[model samples]
Target: MAETMYDKIWNAHAIVERDDGQTLLYVPRHIVQEGSRFAFEFLQDRGLTVRRPRQMLASPQMSISTRRRDIEEITNPDQRLTVELLIENTRKFGVTHYGLDDPRQGIVHVVAPELGFVQPGTVLIIGDSHTCTAGAMGTLAIGVGATDVLHVLATQSIWQRKMRSLRITVDGILPEGVTAKDVILTIVGRIGANGGKGHVFEYAGSAIRAMSVEERLTVCNMSIEAGARSGMIAPDDTTFDYLAGRQFAPRGASWDRALRYWRSLPSDEAARFDREIHIDAATLAPMVTWGTSPEDVVPVDGRIPDPRAEPDAERRAHMEKTLGYMGLAPGTPVTDIAVDQVFIGSCTNARIEDLRAASAMIRGRRAVVPAFVVPGSTQVKHMAEAEGLDVIFRKAGFGWGEASCSMCVGMNGDTVGAGKRCVATISRSAAGRQGRGSRTHLVSPAAAAAAALTGRITDIRKMGA
Candidate 1:
């Protein structure tokens, strides 16, 4: 029988199907972060213990301060307690915990993949929505809530409804200055935010195949923004090479055996998807979000859409309201929009490659606006510093921050001031995502870096040869 990669993996992990159409899927690996404390507390309250301790990894990211790695530096009492509780619970449950000061500590999604815990053909879950980031490794990764976390912790399994599959194929070569970030933003723009609801997106074609593992991760990380249950790419030699020799990846003979299974996990040539979308990578340009939603994206040189041009009255009203919130007017040029700050870091685009791209653009140019560059993980930070990317950012008048969620989520101290406009590499530009009353423009790291240099949104293609 022909099968998509999603179908194959779903069947492999499915233990039983209920009459209600939910399947009990076994979770081989789970990741928890600071916000997972409520689930842990619930388990403790019930006198239950983690069913599979060794299969879980705990880290603190969302609540930790990027200004300093020490737990003491966390000013907010509640946020500090969340980190402390995560440490205590991990130790009590015999799960490995990476504290703020640990060199291996980072955003859970970033840490898990770099440490090789994310493997092809496995089912992994995290409490964070961006858990799909691991799907870049060809794993079936899902994001669960607190109750689901408790269920997975107590049983090492989760009940979920089957999601339809959508295959998005991007052919042709990407143009210069275009990136995976731009590709994904373009997708969200073309397909409304709700277009992929209740579906799992499988990215394919020559363009996807050409992307490095890091770039693939960036694409999959924003799957949630498209309302997809998850997003993934079929594992290939590039995926294998990226996971090779990593801390927890299969080794020696196990690697050879794992490779065989992974090779068989791609969708069969005859497999049919519920839906398919095609994109021409060669025609894509760097994208920037003008409104609060990721779907409000347009090309760097494009103008803010006129609400009156919208055919649907409801959509036109929404566009007008969104423009009010964003402080953008109809027909405004995106390239001419000034920004108060720039933030270049997030699970979506904070890997080593992303930092290198941004640094390359900002080097030898001083930032006209206040800008910050935070790596996705401590290892990413070390790698960047070793490559002198840190020096380049600092010399360019950008603040280099430690690895943490940073301004990506306003829970941390780093944030844009009220009503201030920021160009960011984070997944969302939704209202108050960075801070209350703050306006955000989503773009690729290179675009964000260019905006920092110019104090306005500048087309990355225009910045260099």
Candidate 2:
């Protein structure tokens, strides 16, 4: 049978297929974050140690002792239990080969491919929902929960039901101010949040072909928001070019051989997918979310949808609640909404290119709102400063901060204050996602810049070319 890219990767990693329809998939790379501490303790409680603790932990000796001490200390420190325990846990199971302050020490999804931990044809797993971010490198990567993390930790494998494939092709030239972020947001609005459930989405066509590797990563990173297990763009010159000369990428003679393999990882033209979606990128506009869900989005010039107009009581009620919480009324223009804060960072859209795009927009304009720019990695932060992007952001009234998933998941000390409205480029705007009771409107980097300048939702195209 002719198979799609998802099938090719999944079957390559499949170890055993059970009669009940679950397949044991071998995990080539397991990227973890601070939240994975519980999974380590769970394994310890069951007397099943990590098969290769050295591979996961920074120091095997320290890791064992830290785990033992953290379990006992958990009872005494209620307030700092997770924090202390996680810090200690990472010392034991974390990778010592990389430094936390290293540019590669930011979000796992951002660091993995940047350090070559994610490669073409690999089956990767992480305890993070955004693990799909790694799929940008032509790999099969998915997020698993804590329990599943324990499973993968103990056995280095996971049992999963094979998902069907969805091929999404976006063709034509992208209009000015229309970015990969807008493309994905538009797709989410059309398909709804649960539209791609139980499927892997393969992004292709001329528009995707023209996107940079960083742009492609921005698209694949949000695949989870659309209910897809993973998403990918086939390896091409852009992919190989980005990988070339990277710290962990293949070097010398090996580079040529690796490129050959990556080039062949794409699905054959005759390959078949379970479903297909075609989009005209030329028609996409600068998009922003008006409600809680990613699908509850529209173009910058669009109006808030009227829930009362819908016939389905359940759906209408949900929309009504979302609008109430978002402080939006039916038919109200999204561009008219005011923003108190602006954030331009996350594993989804905080790469160097994202910083450049935002910097270009904010170069001479002072922020009309409290805006902040955080790079995905410390390395990206330093590089941007070297290129004067950091100075540009600061001159525009934006705060430049250290990397580490800042404001993306409300982790660390970064957050939006209570009842404050924010224009953010980060993925996910769920209630309390940024901070308790904070209102978040999602937009692209350019949209975020425009919002910062006007202190309201504004169209990027209105700013300039």
Candidate 3:
């Protein structure tokens, strides 16, 4: 029988179909973080223990501050406890942990792929919505809640209903200024926020295949915001090349066996999806989200959407609310929106490649407003510094931060002040995301750098070669 890439993975990992119509999906990995401490708390309360400790990779990054001068500083009581609890839980459960000072420590999703834990045909879950970031490695990665975390930790499996599959192919070549970030933002805008509900997206085509693994991770990282269970790309030589020498990658004979399987995980010619969307990459523009949602995106050179022109009443109201919160009026050019800050980090866009891209654009120019460049992982940070990317950013007046979420969700000490607007490469842009009354403009690293250069929402295409 013909099967989509999603089907091939799902069937391989599925244990059995339950009476409730949900399948018992075997968990290949449980990527835990500080937020999942509650699952441990629940386990302690119930006297339950982890059935597969080795399968759980725990990280304590959600509450850690990447901007702190003193790495040991943890003044916030709640944030302090979150870290303490994660440490206690990981120790208590005997799960593999990468602590604060560990050179391997980083955001869970970032560290997973960085260490080669996420390979093609893998089934993994994390306690954060952005777990899909690992899906870039061709894994069927999903985010779960505390309850689901407990289940996975105790049994190494969770229940899942069958999901429809959506195939999105962006063919042709991507222009120089346009990027995977822009392509994804353009997709969400065209499909709407709920377009991929109950579906898994298989990202294919010339542009997708041509992107480096880090860029593909950026594309999959925000699939959640578009209402998809996960987004994945077929593994190819590029994917294998990136995973070859990483820490947790299969070794010796095991690697040979793994590689052979990974090569077969791409969709077959006979595979078919429930729906398919095609995009012409040649005409794509650098994208920027004007309002709160990821779907509220437009080309960097485009104008603010007019709510009155929207055909759907509910959509019009949503647009009006988002535009009002963003202090944008209809027909206002995105270029006119001056920003107080530019943040160039997050799991979505903090890889070494992303840093290099932004640094190249920021090298000779000084930022008008404060800007930050937080690496996604320790490995990425070291690589960026080794290449003198940090020097480039600092010379351009951008603060170089350690590997942590940083201003992405305003979780730790780093935050955009109230009433300020920021152009960020983070996955989200909702109200109070960075800080109270702080508006976020979600853009690519290039767009973020352009904003830093001009202190406004400037188009990267207009920034010149």
- Return whichever of 2 and 3 wins on lDDT: 3
Clashing residue pairs for model 3: none
Query: For residues 1-465, could you state the per-residue lDDT of candidate 1 as single tens digits?
Result: 899999999999999999999999999999999999999999999999999999999988888888888889999999999999999999999999988768999988899889999899999999989999999999999998999999999999999999999999999999999999999999998878889999999999999999999999999998888999799999999999999999999998999999999999999999999999999999999999999889999999999999999999988998999999999999999988999999999899999999999998975889999999999999999999999999999999999988988999978789888899999999998989999989999999999999999999999888863
* TM-score for all models, in order of appearance: 0.99, 0.92, 0.98
What tens-digit string does per-residue lDDT give for candidate 3 at 270-388? Answer: 88899999999999999999888889998988899899999999999999999888888899998999899999998999988888889888758899999999998888898898999
Sort order, lDDT high to low: 1, 3, 2
| Residue 339 shift from truth in candidate 3, angstroms | 0.7
Say which candidate scores most in TM-score.
Answer: 1
Q: Which residue pairs show backbone clashes in model 2?
A: 56-93, 57-93, 57-94, 58-94, 63-92
**Which ranges of candidate 3 are over 4 A from the true structure?**
68-71
Return the TM-score for candidate 1, rounded to 2 decimals.
0.99
lDDT of 2 by residue, 72-130 (tens): 42233432455456557666554443334234556667777776767888888888888
